[model samples]
Target: MAESDGQERTEQPTEQRLRQAREKGQIPRSKELGTAAVLLSAAAALLMLGDALGEALSMVFEQSFRLERAAIFDPATMMPALAEAIGGLMWPLLGMFAVVLVAALVGNSLLGGFNFSTQAMMPKFSRLSPVNGLKRMFGVQALVELLKSIAKVVFIATIAIWLLWSQFDHILRLSGETLNLAMKDALELLLWMGLALCLALLPIVAIDVPFQVWNHTRQLKMTLQEVKDEYKNTEGKPEVKSRIRRLQQEMANRRMMAEVPTADVVVVNPTHFSVALRYDKDKPGAAPVVVAKGLDEVALKIREVAREYQVPVISSPALARAVYFSTKLDREIPDGLFVAVAQILAYVFQLNAWRKGQGNKPVPLKDDLPIPDEYRV
Candidate 1:
């Protein structure tokens, strides 16, 4: 088990961890499985093509040995004779090679799928250290591999002894048979023995496959701190995120405060809420847009900025609260509040006219204005 800063690694590796390990060529592998596949594949090919292979070998033997006296004496004839002999056996040999090649590929693919990592091929100076080499040679994984090898040798030897003992009578009878028949019987016996040996490897493969997978996972296990660090790297640190959010809020507030000067009127809910509105005289059909709206301290700040800019601050509790809650910044007030806001804008326009001596003083805006039921926040 691996550890981080005195903490034991017990957590399963994350997807990112596993992917990184794979990139470095750290993946589960079973030598037993690969060996079994090669042996079994070769045994199957031999079983299927044994007669054809035997006939080819026999033909090659006859050609090489049953030569004319003149041809045997001629060194120039030897190369052609060898070529003919090789051609006779080529197809059967090729068939066996093809089967073994396919088996090796399929067997290895069964476990870790397939990944080609160039990093695995890169040379590392750490691997050349004598201390590291000794550590690896005497490691827990090395011990396990040694035990498995010993067990395989013992198991296979026992199987071989038992097989020979059981087939003793048939082996002795082969010596008394004709050369052709004996060769055929020997080929058949070898094929059967190869199959039995391959079958004997299956139990080892079964044990080794799971052990390799488990060991690989164990090696990649993460400690508690490692998991937290990985999360921080992936999602970002909380303090940093908080700072970003605070900065973003500050920037937005500065922009909102900037809009306060341009507002036509700042409606206030006494001391609790404030909403700044601006009507575009150029677009007569457009409703007034709430350039800024805030609560509590922010509301006080809006009012302060409004006063500094000499903007009209209308004290309307119901209307301010309604607009504050219902209207978003930079959006037009809802259609339900259109009539009430129109009255306020008209009053402000009239008040400005009277101040400029262009019209008579307007009537005071009644606190209990025509606020619709749904628009009342």
Candidate 2:
């Protein structure tokens, strides 16, 4: 049994959920996806930057090595080659962008049934509030952001230290060379630095991906009123209690008649209402309760099935209607009819005892209750 609190608890709106998620330092914010795009984009940008520096050093290093003649590197001759190289690389770069875009979309989708809304962007002048700005600066979210920054610095420094140790021999090797050679070497170092940067940024990326999803879910939260509205839409408007009761009774009658087998007796109106009653012999002084009841054609089906099952069919029209109208299935017979029903049950039990050849047991019942002649069988 539920205690009546009279207040129904419903879900909160998406914005509140998002605001809470954000406060908790949950990751994968919307901008993080954009950040992933930037990271991947940086990879391509680094490649180009590395290439330009490499070419400048190539010019100086070629002269120092005395290996070949320097035909001044011309844009006109190299432009086509550059275009060809870019075309070759385009597929992979596009794939990288696509992966980030899809990951962001999926993470966002899972966090909430994420829906895009510009409503969040529809103009706010909250920047004027110095108090809110101060709160944001000192908030839990600000703390998380500060932690992420510290982690990135630590990660990058560790990688750089490792790189220095690994490349110490090369740095010490005396290759009599010019500024071009130094620039080329530095460019090579920067290429590795880009990778280390991406690696260092990975934690922030991981964190933000989840936050983005959480942020999206928060935007779609359901307020109490919205929860009720959606439920009503799904379940349809509530029906009157009386109508619900009637439908329940009708369904019960159909089910009851289907279980006419194994009943001890069925009290009937001969042509109108029929009710099948069953009693467990273990229970004493308790009259059989109605298991199935029907009026009109359904009543006829109950009698037909009762006859087929060879259950005793007692014609007691007044009792049949009284029990059918006054009691519910699986409940005890009502107080008013307890004595009359007990006698009928006793008579039925004696008949069963006689059939089993136990003894000649006399029917143990009294006359029926007085009722209208029209309803009497």
Candidate 3:
């Protein structure tokens, strides 16, 4: 569906998208960097352990050539000698291999860290398609890889040739030197050559690392619609969120209406607004709190609930609207409207008292209640 949109991918990927890609083992990695590191590590290991390696190799050569009368006649004796010779050769090589392995792992980890994912190990049949294979072989990525390979070859060859040419005089005189001196000269020359090659590779690694990162980021670019879709997936679809909000409002209204029966009075703006106020003499607040409030149809419902529960319904348009707008449900009415609500509550109490024949009938509530001018609207 996203591909069908034909939207150009321009935006940088979000963190979630990047994280998903990482989980799938799709992370920037430069093969050149790992190759260079392994090469350098192997060269360093050989240089550091040169004496020990030479001794091991000499032992292997000596063992292979040394023939005792028993070793020459007995095949079983020969097998043990051959095995000892092989073990001598393997030790130095194994040390070099270990160094190379460590270097390769460190180089790869420097860029993308360590991520073990089976998703990358899974094979896809699409890789077998000729068209896809040709595209991969001749694509921009392939072209870039070809260029990098050519550059690396040229750089290494140039360094090697330059080093060898500079040491040509020394090389020609090697035949006149003692065996130990000749061996030392050759070792030094090889070390210099290896160092030169390693240095040459540094530039290629520098360029390839940034190129790999850029290519990976470009491939992960997101279209505008994709961003919106991802947002919806992570947050919620707009319509679904709206429906949820509507359901929450309905539930809140039901709960508010349930509180109407316990309210001392329901103040109304005729048929438009309604606010149910409740006051507890033992509560800390000095004024009544609005327990329920609604507008229009909800107001009608509040009034009906109030009547059904025999709660007093007072017509106070300004006070009702003011309380409904300014006060939150289950919170005390603002100080500005305290006097007005107090007078209404006093009237309701008096009416109740009169109904039970305990007090004189209260006068009708005045239109001009003690509501502040600012709260009039």
Best by lDDT: 1
RMSD (Å) of each candidate, 1 decimal: 7.9, 13.7, 7.3
Tens digits of per-residue lDDT for model 2, 220-332: 55556666676666556667656888899888777787778867899888989888888877887766777888789888988889989899888877888888887787776
User: Residue by residue across 1-377, what tens digits does model 1's lDDT show?
Assistant: 54446889899999999999999999998888889999999999999999999888878876877898899878899889988889989999999999999999988877887889999999999999999999999998789889888999999999999999999999999999987788889999989987998999999999999989998999899998999999999888899999989999989999999999999999999789999999998996888999998989999999999999999999999999899888889999998888889999999999999999999999999878899988787
- Tens digit per residue, CA lDDT, model 3, 263-340: 999999997999999999786745788999999999999999999999999998999989988999889888998889
Candidate number with the higher TM-score (1 or 3): 1
Question: Candidate 3 overall Cα lDDT vs. reference?
Answer: 0.87
TM-scores of all models? 0.65, 0.38, 0.62
lDDT of each: 0.92, 0.67, 0.87
Select the stronger candidate by lDDT from 2 and 3: 3
| Higher-ranked by lDDT: 1 or 3 | 1
Q: Clashes in model 3: which pairs? A: none
Show model 3 residue runs off by greater than 4 Å. 1-6, 63-77, 176-185, 242-377
Off by over 4 Å in 2: 1-33, 44-53, 56-117, 172-175, 178-183, 211-226, 229-377
TM-score of 3: 0.62
